[model samples]
Target chain A: MKFEIMRDRLLDGLNDVTKAISSKTTIPILTGIKIDVTDNGVLLTGSDADITIQTFIPAEENGDQIINIIETGSIVLQARMFNEIVRKLPTNDVEIEVENEFQTHIRSGKTEFHLIGSDASEYPLLPKIDDENKFEIPADLLKAVIRETVFAVATSESRPVLTGVNWIIENDELICVATDSHRLARRKVKLENLPTDVDSIVIPGKSLNELNKILDETSNPVQIIMSNQQILFKTDHVLFFSRLLEGNYPDTSRLIPTEFKTNITLDGKTLLQAIDRASLVAREDRNNVVRFETLEDNAVKISSNSPEIGKVEEQIPVHSIDGDELVISFSAKYMMEALKAIDGQGQEVIVQFTGAMRPFILRQVNDDSILQLILPVRTY
Target chain B: MKFEIMRDRLLDGLNDVTKAISSKTTIPILTGIKIDVTDNGVLLTGSDADITIQTFIPAEENGDQIINIIETGSIVLQARMFNEIVRKLPTNDVEIEVENEFQTHIRSGKTEFHLIGSDASEYPLLPKIDDENKFEIPADLLKAVIRETVFAVATSESRPVLTGVNWIIENDELICVATDSHRLARRKVKLENLPTDVDSIVIPGKSLNELNKILDETSNPVQIIMSNQQILFKTDHVLFFSRLLEGNYPDTSRLIPTEFKTNITLDGKTLLQAIDRASLVAREDRNNVVRFETLEDNAVKISSNSPEIGKVEEQIPVHSIDGDELVISFSAKYMMEALKAIDGQGQEVIVQFTGAMRPFILRQVNDDSILQLILPVRTY
Candidate 1:
């Protein structure tokens, strides 16, 4: 590939694709980034075996020229080293030229580098899916959904399907659910033009994390297309493709409580802080367990103790409590994370539980878009 | 002990002494912090086998009462957990009361902690260093000296003395030298009340690093007292004790060349950046070797090439060139680090070398307080 491109524009394109590059991949070519220069612009692709990212820089952006294509060609350069070289180049523009042996020369100002490049043809072809099932969503909203639910996904591979966030759609309602048995997080967003053929699909939590980071750097409309086993998230100049899990996700609807014997509302920030203190001495390997109990005075007691270290007790005032006084215990770490995920400007959340041994549900008092559930630990 | 102290004031004391608590220490008591509530104020102490740090909170500071003394007693609490608990307490003041069997109750607002404390007698006493050879230096100046030379100390324990910085005082001048054999860094400062009996000593680089961090957070005079095998640094409310290395530091005077065949000057920042780019393709395990050669046109070519990676070349402008034409190779990593230590305010530095195989010297033109030296690597 031979081209002269603005350093900043090329660097940006390289960075986006770099997120998908696996340095420890078993495939040699996957460790390199394929660069293709054409009359249209310059294209960069990076991929591991499971996911791929491609970014394009047009010949011109807005009214300014971003690339001057002298020759249309392709080559692959070591992703890690090439990115570092590009960042440290001393000029505003970089000229890259690949010679006969695929020895690519990159020059910027008085500095020049000749890199050993691999044949771009060795790179695996990006999977192409029929565009019959696709829908557009604000990139910001998708990022929010991923953040709210992805954290609850199973991190272990014991049940491979649970490692992904389950996406379900019906009647133009986009729902995402993630559960690791002990806790579950679900978020729903209304869709305007939901594709009729699209059904439930499981996308790996890791892939969602990478896509969320990309969306964080941009605010644009993202078109998502789903096929039999692969899904793609495409933005203006970037395309992110991820593989889907094949097995059916477990039924989590029954895991969430339908009725409650006790309901309590408390400020999210106050409860989060109280649990944080109570967990200070709790053993991390023990899940940092903390106990909660309702007092007749309408205040809730949060406490935790480590036999070898110390014990902490906190009396946090609550907005209200109904039904019988309740006592339950759960992982303080999980509770704190749940509270933080629903946390906002003095906002309060209602906790509904059937019994000490049953799973409890937490949700913002007035918002139905997000719900979190945690299975209580038996500690009488 | 029974007392109520401002949370922030107590926290500051805890943080200062907590630096010396070794989390992995074999000595069990070293993992705990000793807290003594005295008639004057509260004192906190933490120690590992090698170093100890103590901090005091006065009853009043700047005419404001910092603590309300109810009784006097002493106890030792687990350092790591107590600090975390103190940081998350819910009130402005924390009330601590020790009852029978060393059961300590800490309360703030409606939150309380019952910590298992050991008898304070189990804690090791801070070594008492004689004050006969004591001298005072501004905390900022000591911190600066540490920063300038500590990086040159040998990181490996193979050469025990090289792992510390050699400190010397004579003729009303204090000079500190450190070297890992391949390179040497020396810094000197004029002493006003030079101790007549003090000659030379070596302080562990790790201890100096910790002291530098403490100094960075405060501005006050630090009195350093050197004894037979220990050193003590004392400030208004803090006392730091560090053991001295027994062996004599190697003489590094001969490592610095007094005359050279090639004397060149360049902009520190420019040479630093050029070397950085050249080292990008160099093998990391081999110190990222880069070559430098003088051109007849008063410019120097900085280049590096790796068979498996690539080649990089840069032409850096020079301020002046003296003596003979030269081509030499050295560790780009060492050169960059040395340059960064001297980098500031677009300064210029002089490079002096005897030949392609001799050790070279770098200094800030006419500034004699600091000097850096590096040995060359022979490359055919």
Candidate 2:
């Protein structure tokens, strides 16, 4: 394999693929990124058994020489070192070549690096996906959905299925749900064009985070293909594939209550700041719980107490109030996460409660598309 | 103590004092910051046995009200929590009140925090300096000197004195030296005013780092007070105190050779990047060493090799060359640190070598105020 590519262009492609390479992977070949040089351009691939990423660099971009492919061949080199060398290389154009013995030579300006490479054939082949099951969504929209719900997934690995976010599609509506049993986050959006079929898939939160990191926030659409056990998201020049978890997701539809005895609407920023102050005291406790008490005339009391770190109480004004007077305790971290996911500046949010013992819901005052629920902590 | 102070002013003072408060200290009271409200203003102090910081918030600053003292008293509160609370408070003016029972109430806007406070009597007293040994230096210059020499101190606790930077004053010139046996850093500055006698002191690197973080890059002067067991730095309204190390610092005067067999001049940035690239390959080896081979006519060859990570070689252009060709291997990290300390962009540095086994020196082309020496690694 032999090619000459721009320094920044190659670094960008390498960074995109490197998200899938893991240093602790048991598969030795998975630690390296595969480089395939063709007459058209060059393709870089990296995987760690769970997820695979492939990025392509074209021959030219904007009338500037991006890649010059001299021969067609393939080789695998260490992902981390390769990325660092290309980034720190002191020239505008870098020349990369692979010998018959797989000794890769990378030269830029006066800097040259010779790396031992492995046979690309040793890497596990990526599974093929049918294009018929693919659907399109804006890259930013997908990233937003992942960021809103992925943090709620259980990360302990004790329940492997709970570590994944459940994606459900019905009647051209897509809903994503993630929960760690203590708290839950769900987001729903209407699909632009979809087939009259229902489908469900559970994707690991880890994979979604990696996808979020690599996906650019552009209007460009990303094509997603789903199979029985794997899913793939393809963008302009990058392909991301991840294995799905097998298990039945809990029926969270029944978990959110339809009626509430009390509802309080308050500015998200004000409430977030109040909770942040309370958290400084509550975080010393195991559950990190803070209590919220609704007062008369659009006022609320926030308080947290730790035996060792003392206590903190804050009064925050609300926008509106109705229904029963309520007092409840929940994780301060969960509340902060819910507030951050809400869109719009200084928008008011309604907190609905069925009872102190049941799970309560937090929703935007004007919209119900995104809902975050937190179970109250029982304090004696 | 009872006072109403500007939120930002109180927060700034709290943050500076909190740097000396360590949660892991065996002395429990050291984790709290003591606050004294007097008729003059408010004084905030924090200490962790090894270091102490005290900052006074005056009644007014630049024709603006900063502190309004209502009562004269004192109390201590958890440093970390107090700093966080003050920063997150929602109002420009914060009201702080201490009850007779030692309960502290901090109110900002509608948010209020009630913290269990400690008796100020339990906190350690500040060290006393009776002697009038004092001098003044520019804050930026002191910060620069600390940054250049502090990184070379030994981190291991086997020799506690080596973890500090030695400061020696002679003939109105302040000389700072630090080393961990493998490498050494020295910086000297001539002062306008001289004390009657010469003096030397060792200040812990950790304390200096904390001081550096709190210093603002202004032309303001920092007054230094040296005593038998402690050193104090007073800048504007803030006072910083650090305990001196007891043992004698090693004499590093003879370690830097005055003459050399080979000397090479190169650009600081170019050499730094080449070493960084070579480090990617050398890191896989046991010693993590990179070699530099001086070539004829203003050229230097840099290379590194590891059995598992392959090899890398690059030629860095130089400004000038002298003496014989030389090949020496050393730690890439140390070399990079020295390069970062150079004051000017595109500055040329002369690297002087005595022998392959001796320590090499790096100095600016026309300035002898700063010097860096690195011991060569045995590559065999």
Candidate 3:
């Protein structure tokens, strides 16, 4: 393969695909990135057996020549070295040429590198999936959904299905739920073009994290297609494919409380700071729990203590409070995560609780697109 | 101890002294920072046995009030946690109040923390040294001298004295030298005040590194005092002490060749880039070595290769070349460090060598303030 492309444009495309490349992969070939050149431009592919990322550089961008193609071929080169070389090249454009075998030469300015390449046929092919259920969503909205729920997924491998986020679609409403049994996060949004019937799929949290990183901040639309076992996300000139986790996801609908005896509204920033201070002392223990006690209708007591690390207590002002006085303890990290996911101009959030042991829910006053739930710790 | 101090000013002072604190120290008290409140102001000290840093926070700076002391006492607190808490406190001012025992209460904003403070008497005392040999140098210039030579010190601890920088005072010139046997760096400066007789001392590389980090980018002069076994650096409000290495530093005066058969001058940035590109391939090997070959009178070739990785070659333009054509190889990391220490805008550096197996010297035209030497590696 012989072709020349702009250094910056090629670096961008290479970076997007490199997110899937694992340096410590058991399969040696999986550590290399496959490059293919054609009349269309160049395509770079990297995969780690679980997810595959492919990015294409077009021949022209904004009516300017980005790639001047002389020949068309394919080869696989070491991902880590290739990326570093491209980034440090001292020129605006890079020329790559592959010879009879798999020896590829890259030239830019006065610098030239001859890299040992592998046969492109050695790379595992991406899983083939029929476009059965396909829908479109704004890239930013999808990124927000992933960010809100993905962090709550179980990180342990004991329960593989629990390590994935559950996506459910019904009547054009898109619901994403993630839980680790200790805590849960759920977000719902109305879809522009929802799938016909009721559908549910579990995508790994790690895959969503990689996808979120590649999604830009633009308002571009992303088309998603799913088969029985795999899902494909296409945006601009890039394609991301992730394998679905097998088995049924737990029924989290029953875990979220439907009623509440007490509700408290407080500024999210103030509560976050109080919890952060408390966590400095609480995180030393096994449970890492922080207690929230309501003294008056407009004030809440936040306190945490550890046998070895001393104790912390603070009074946080609240906008409004009602019903029975409550003192509940839960994971400080979980509460912090839930608070960070709430993004709005107003700093107040309404927290609803059914009982001391029951899972509580947190939501913004006027915005209901996001929801956070935390299971209280039993500290008798 | 009871006092209210401006949070930002106190944090800044603590940061300077905290550089000597080590989290992995075997001595428990070394991990704690000693705070002594006097009528004048507050003094904070942190030490890791090998190096001690003490900084005084005055009652006021410029026109801003810093410390308001109500009681005079001393206490020791965990260095790491105290620094972090002070940095993230949610107030402009912080109040620290201690009871009869060692229970300390720190209040900022609405948050309060009860910490278990230790007795300041338990902490190790910093060494006190008085030396007749003293000199002053610009803070920036002293920082530069340390940066240039410290990197060449032996990091492996195989050679005890080689792990320190040799400071020699002769006539009115202060010279610093460091060598790990493979590479050497030397820096010289003219001083107004010097002892009548010549003197030499070896300070630990790690100590110099921490001292450099603590030095601000001001034009204030730093006083250097040297004794038989210890060296002290005193600033206006900070005092730093470093123990001298016991063994005699090797005499390297004969290692640098005064006459050379080959010489070349090249732009530092251009050579840096060429060496960087060559490093990409060389780093795959055990030594990470790159080779340089002079061509004719105005060009040089840089190259590196690994059997499993690939090969990289680049041409670096030179300002001038004389004597004979030569080829040499050395660690790319060493060359990069040497290039970074030479400060100037588009300056040409003269590199001289006597033979392929001997140490080569690098310097700027008519400037003896800085000199770098690298030992060649045998390629065969």
Candidate 4:
């Protein structure tokens, strides 16, 4: 492969693809970035068996020449060293050439680096994900959904399926839910202009995090294509492909209670701050458990006690409270995270609970698209 | 302590002392911060066996009443939890009352924390350091000296004495030197209006790092009291005490060669950048070694080659070269660090070499107050 590419463009591509390249991967070839010079542009691919990321640099972008391809060829270079070389190459323009023996030469301004490359054929071929079940979502919207729901996914692999965020699409609406049995986060968004059949896919939480990282600062629409086993998110110049988990995601629709005897609207930030203060002592305990109680006259209390350490009690003023006088205990960390995930959307959180033993729900005051729920612990 | 202290003032004091509180300390009480409310002010002390940091909050400062003394008492509270509580308190003024039973109640706004406090009598007492050998230095200058020399201290504990920085005081001048045998860093400064006999002290590098962190933003003069077994640094509000190393520091004067067969002056930033780029390839090698050669003209070349990887060669333009043609190899990491420490002094680096295998010297151009030496490797 021979090409002269813009430094910033190549650096951006390298950083994007590098997210998928893992140093601990067992496959030796997966540790390298596959570079191919094509007629349209130069394609850089990085994969770690679980996810694959590819970024393309066209011959020209935004009326500026981005890459001038001299020949069409491919080579896999060590991702980390290659990334460092391209980023610190001391020039605005970079020229790369691969010899017949897989020797890659990268030159920029006053610096040049030659790297030993591997044959591209040694890399595992990425599975083809047909566009049969394709959809479109604004990059920012998808990023927001992932940010709002991915944090609740179970980090433990005991259940395996709970480590992923389940995506369900029906009637041009998309809903993503992630739960760790103790707490859950769900977000829904209406799709636009794409006609597709109902589908369900569980994507690993880690892959969603990488997708969110790459989508940062870009507002372009992202085209998503789902095959039987793989899902692809194609952004402006990047294609991110992640393998779908093979399992039945536990049905969570029946988990959220629709009928609530109590509903309290509270300032999201104030309650978050109160819980935060209580957690100062709660963290010393293994469970990080804090108790919340509804008070009279639009007031509530949050407290945590640790016998060896101390106890913290905070009173938070709410906008309105009409809930059956209740006392519930749950993880202070979980509640804080859920509140923060929905706190800054220009709305307070409306909390609803059936009783102290059932799972409680927190919804944005006026927004019905996002909901977070937590099961109370038996701390009596 | 039973007092109402300004949250900001108390927070600052807590942060200062918390630096010396190590969670992993063997002494159980060392994980707690001792709070003493006296007639003059409230003093907070935190110590691990090696270092103790005490910060005092006066009852009043600059016409502002910072603390309202309700009663005089002492208690030891868990450092980590107390620090977090004070920082996250919900009021400008914090009211802390210690019950007779060692139960402490911290009240701020509508939030309160009750912590099980330990008896202050269990905490280690601060050492008594006589002013017999005391001097003062500007905090900024001392901080700069520490930053320049601490990085060169030996990390390996094989030679315990080399793991500390040796401070030599004589003729109203203070000299600090640190070396790991492979490279050495020395910095010196003249004292003003301070009379003291010649003295030398060796302080652990880790203690110096902690001292640097506490001196992060303040620029006041700091009083230094050197006792037989301890050194005390007293600022306006914080008193930092560190145990001194007992063994004698090595005499390193004979290691720096005075005669030079080659002398080259180069821009510090440029040389640093070239070396940094070269290190990207050299890092994979066990030694992280890079080669430096003096060119015929006003130029120098830095290159590193990895057999499995490729080689990188860069010619760094120098201001002047007046020495025998020379080639030497040294640890790129050490050279980069030394160059960086000397780079931002608004001056270039003057390199002096005795021979290919001799210890070479790097000094700030036109300034002899600071000097760095590196021993060359016999690379075949």
- lDDT string, candidate 3, B114-152, tens digits: 888899988887666767877788898899899989999
Residue-wise lDDT of candidate 4 within B138-163, one digit each (tens)? 89988989998999999999999999
Tens-digit lDDT string for candidate 1 (B131-218): 7998888898898788889999999999898999999987888999989998888899997886778689999999999888777545
Measured with C-alpha atoms, the lDDT of residue A31 in candidate 3 is 94
- DockQ-based class of model 1: high
Per-model TM-score, in order, reads: 0.97, 0.96, 0.97, 0.96
Stretches off by above 4 angstroms in model 4 are A217-219, A344-346, B216-219, B344-346
- At residue A102, candidate 2 shows an lDDT of 91
Which residue runs of candidate 3 sit more than 4 Å off their true CA positions?
A344-346, B61-64
Q: DockQ each candidate and list the results.
A: 0.90, 0.74, 0.75, 0.77
Instruction: Give one digit per residue, the lDDT tens place, for model 2 in B106-213.
Output: 988877788889999888888788557888999999899999899999999788999999999888799999898899999999997745553888999999999999
lDDT tens string, model 1, A1-380? 68999899889999999999998899999999999888989989999978899999999878888899999999999999999999999988899999986999999999999998999998999888889899999888888888899999998999999999999987879989999989999998999888888689999999999998888534578999998799999998899999999899987877777889999988888898898898886654366889999997779999988887778898999999998878899998788878877763389889998989889999899997899999999865
Clashing pairs in 3: none
Worst 10 residues of 2 chain B by lDDT: B192-201
> Could you list the iRMS of every candidate?
0.8, 1.6, 1.6, 1.3
DockQ ranking from best candidate downward: 1, 4, 3, 2
lDDT of each: 0.89, 0.88, 0.89, 0.88
